[model samples]
Target: MNLHSTPPRSGAVLAALAGAQFTVMLATSIVNVALPQIRVGVGLSDGGTTWVVNAYGLAFGALLLAGGRAADLLGRRRVLMAGLGLFAVASLTAGLAGSSDVLIAARAAQGVGAAAIAPAALALAMGLFPSGAGRGRALGVWGAVSGAGGAGGVLLGGVLTQAWGWPWIFHSVAFGTVLVLAAVAALIPRASSAEGGKFDLLGTVTITVSLTCLVWGLTTARGSGWTDPGVLGALLGSTVLLGAFVVIERRRSDALVPPRLFRTGRVAAGNLLMALLGSVWIALFFFLPLYQQQVLGMGPLATGAGQLPLAAANMLGASLAPRVSRRIGDSATVIAALLTTAAGMLWLARISADGSYVGHVLGPSILIGLGLSTAFVQLTALAVGGVPPQDAGLAGGLVNTTRQVGGAIGLAALATLAGTVTTHAAVTRTPQLEAVTAGYRAAFTVSAAVLTAAALLALLLTRRSGWQRTVATAPARRSAEPRASAVS
Candidate 1:
């Protein structure tokens, strides 16, 4: 289909695309609250349980570029449907898993599916809305959907795990996948495949291997010391592999990630900011539930309930972000969001064994949620800001890949740091509760610092001159065309 020439069915297309995006993102964090139950049910060790999360993230992060390029070469609708089917099947397999190995494998399979779905869905959404206010609004809704999915995953996982079993989380995802599949079939227009590009097999393989090795090394650092030969070897191998992949991409005629994309300052800055933001956000989800359950003696249901405010605030912030950006500009919005998030993380660093949920958790959650939601919308726009239409899927994949890879690395590093702190404090005869709280606090402090650094980088690296030029020209560009139909 000629996306620009077609009569806009914006509502149906946006709904279908956003639904697919939500389904894929939901799986990203759906198991956070159920990690404890899954560990017991599958007889997993602490290290093995971590893989339950990392395996999916690693595969998803590694394969996203390949998937995005494939969608460009193949038809987006065709690739999207195939991905949804694969996701549903993988969800079923995960739900039925009786061993950690099986569950991890299934989760990795789900990641492969998610890698395809995310970029295609994002590209399709971009295609549905023309540039200017319409595109900005659509992206805001897209960001809101993504935030809701991430936050809701925790709530839903807790509810399902409490009422049924850990397996129910996967089952619920499977059901949602089926519904989204039907929506895609009905609402998404079929497009002719773009032909003539050679797949970058060498680049794909090397990059995938490099990321896999990096995640494996990070994950192993917790069990074996960071200085362990195996961990050091894997990390070194990953660095070499990544260097090789970059070389291959430079040489390839049809590179998976076109090197020119990195030349744009906004694209580069946005991606770096996303990487830092994702690291802290994922670490928060991983550690906060443990704090509530282990330190505050909260049940799964209560923990889930406590997260509702965060989810709601995230949605509200996302909806308002685009409007805010119109007045303040995207860079200013991003900087403001990062500073707000950093402040929230700093507040959370004060958590004590005796801290109350309302006093400590609720306030920080609101700040972090609002910050994440607002930043996510603007960052996504910034990442893809000036890219050609043909490269939308590639841009989407790059942003998503950075987020997943950052999450995987961050979770592993923070988890290891927390474990080390807790272990040392215990060895020194500190009370267990106090020791764990100290570890959480230390992690939160680091997270705050990371956000502060990201804010500074945004200030330094974001191309203000180029962005201002685009904003200055947007009104003239939009005025020449007829008004596009509103999605809602």
Candidate 2:
């Protein structure tokens, strides 16, 4: 069942893997448009509602490294199938949940499944296509699928929520997961077992506990003050656990994540950039629906229609990213895309209580979508670039873990800032709409600043020399590679 010995049905393999990734991302974004309905239906308070999102992000981020290591040690295909089965069951549970608590728990279960599926799928794809032109093309397609899924979710969620109900969003993902499972079973070959090594149990437990505590602390801080005893305790606990994880990893031969992975500038910069991008990207989806539906008095359907341009633009950018990278180089392309996205955020920061979607939302959505999609393609390539094949799942997991963790933490911080701003405005007797708009604007402005900083960091940290080394070594490795002959 070693995929290395199987026939190379690269097209079919890529399609199956990308489809699985699409399902996971689509589930994440699909909830955004349905949040208002879910809140109302489940009788959730504002503080309780954020948990619906945070719970998933927390579980996904915290366990991703362990999930990746599991994929490596247990065999990627076996882990992937099990993950998909779990994801399907979780989605069904979510769809049937009648209370906020039940839904949140179900979502967290889904995250556990996603943590396994994401890294294993990426590792499988990487195994299918060796580094060189083939890897570049496969990554491009992968990026496009991710962008399309994320952007398309808003529209799809709106349509389903308006026509059927919010639960259909979960139902739809469940159905898609079933389809992906079938395709994956048919197309992807079984992976060989990794070389014998003990699982890093201490490292896994500490990292997972640390991230969960950290995200919980941040999310709780929005409702309870930062100085609240619970908040302080959780944050302190997270810090201690994280320190322990680092120490355990340094001492362990079979580390959950090899410390040496971060020594490469490409890996470090790529993950950092993705973390920053995820912070803003997730926040945008969370807030925009609220702005459109609550502030502008649009329906779910209208909001979905309004976001169609973003979906289209994201696909366009993803499609163009490989060519753009070829012309400008990966680092420059990423820098340019970040700057473009920052400008879009700045424009969005101008939103007002009386603003129209056409004037205030459309243009910026397109711009931001394009920038994010372009960056996604190159970032995906950069993340797995120059990594040995055996560690592919670990690398993928690390990149994705940063993104989800960054989203969880950043959203909490921005949500708190927005709430504080709105509360102060309310105390001063500002109009409710105006106060809310002010809060949203504040978040957008801060998001812009974050993206700008990411661009600067990418510029300083991503070295051309590292890319040259990858390119030079890639062909030599490919020359010694055996060709697989699977039927597509």
Candidate 3:
């Protein structure tokens, strides 16, 4: 399977790496679509249910940087294989779990596995492709995997949950992981480890603890209120731990994440866009199914079907990114994407209990999907675009960190909003269903507002005279070489 020097083999490598992304994304999406069923089956309370998704996100976000550094130190191939092994086993555990605790624990483990694999996979893709146009195309395909994952997960989750059971969704991940593991063994060439560094245990601990506490507080704050002692304690604890992490990194010879990486406009902008996108991204994932099942009275299958437009549009957008970027440049493309997404979110805010899916949901789905697809492709390109080849793993890891942290924060924020709205509406209820729908609408409005801000942020960062100008002025600008040169 060693295709180290052969250019054609790069395609095989991308396939293996992309397949890894596809499998992990599928596991989450399918789970998301089946949330209503899972709630009933696992006896998850409204507030507690968020953990079904958050557990994975929190672990993945917290551990991703460490995972990336580990890949650089241990060898990408070995780390990737180990991650696959852990993911497969965790999937099995999640599928077979008889209780909520077990399932959540398993999902968290799966997230850790995903965190490990993501950096290695991206770094390997970079190794196979190099920086330039070819790398951009490869990154285009890479971006597609992410969009496709979001869309496809709903469909897959729908079909599996409806036909089989929620457990089957987890089982399917296990099966897919096994296949991907085998495929990697058969397809991708072995890569030598890049230069290594000492393990940053203190930096790793500080980040993990800091992020966990922060996300926990945020997630819990909706029900507990910001002033709750528990919430305040977690937030304060997070700040102290994170502050220590920054200091620790400054003291370390080989820090987990170099402060210099933040100096690049693309890197910083990409991270911001990712966090904003993540917040909006996970909000939809968290809310849409609830809306469909609760407000629209859609069955699992029907709810899953409802998401078809979003998924299809996302894939379409991803496929079209290369052409769009070619015409408008990445900055313009990203700005357009973010604006479209914001507009869609605003439109979606108008959805009433009586609203039709095609009339209300379809257009927003298409716009949001397109926006995310475009933004994701360019953000990824920009994030990794400037890194030295040796720091490819770090670049990949850091970008992912932005995305996952955003996701965690978004879920917490939305869940809290939803809870507050529902509780308020409950007191004013004439009919229970109407009250619930009102709450959902309220949550959607807040989500739309959040996404609108995200759009502004994306616009500001990607503006020609703002961040893009910085990218243009950088000492070592990314060469706009064609994909063939970058990949070969």
Per-model TM values vs. the true structure = 0.94, 0.94, 0.91
- Please tell me which predicted candidate would have the highest TM-score against the true structure: 1
Output the lDDT of residue 116, model 1. 95
Candidate 3 structure, TM-score to reference:
0.91
Regions more than 4 Å wrong, model 1: 1-8, 463-465, 469-488
Model 1: per-residue Cα lDDT over 1-488, one tens digit each: 34444556667778888988998888988998898899999999988888888788878888888888777667577878899999999999999999989999999999999999998888777666646777778788888889889888888998999999999999999999999999888776565445337777888889888988887888788778899999999999999999998888888778988877766567777788898898988888888888998999998888888888888888888888888888887778889999999999999999998898998899999999899988888888877766655577778888998888787788878888898899999999999999999999989999999999999888876655354422211464643332222110
Candidate 2's residue-wise lDDT over 264-302, tens digit each? 667877788898998988888888988998899998889
Local error of candidate 1 at 305, Å? 1.3
Better of 2 and 3 by lDDT: 2
The TM-score, computed over Cα atoms with residue i paired to residue i, of candidate 1 is: 0.94
* Model 3 lDDT-worst window of ten: 479-488
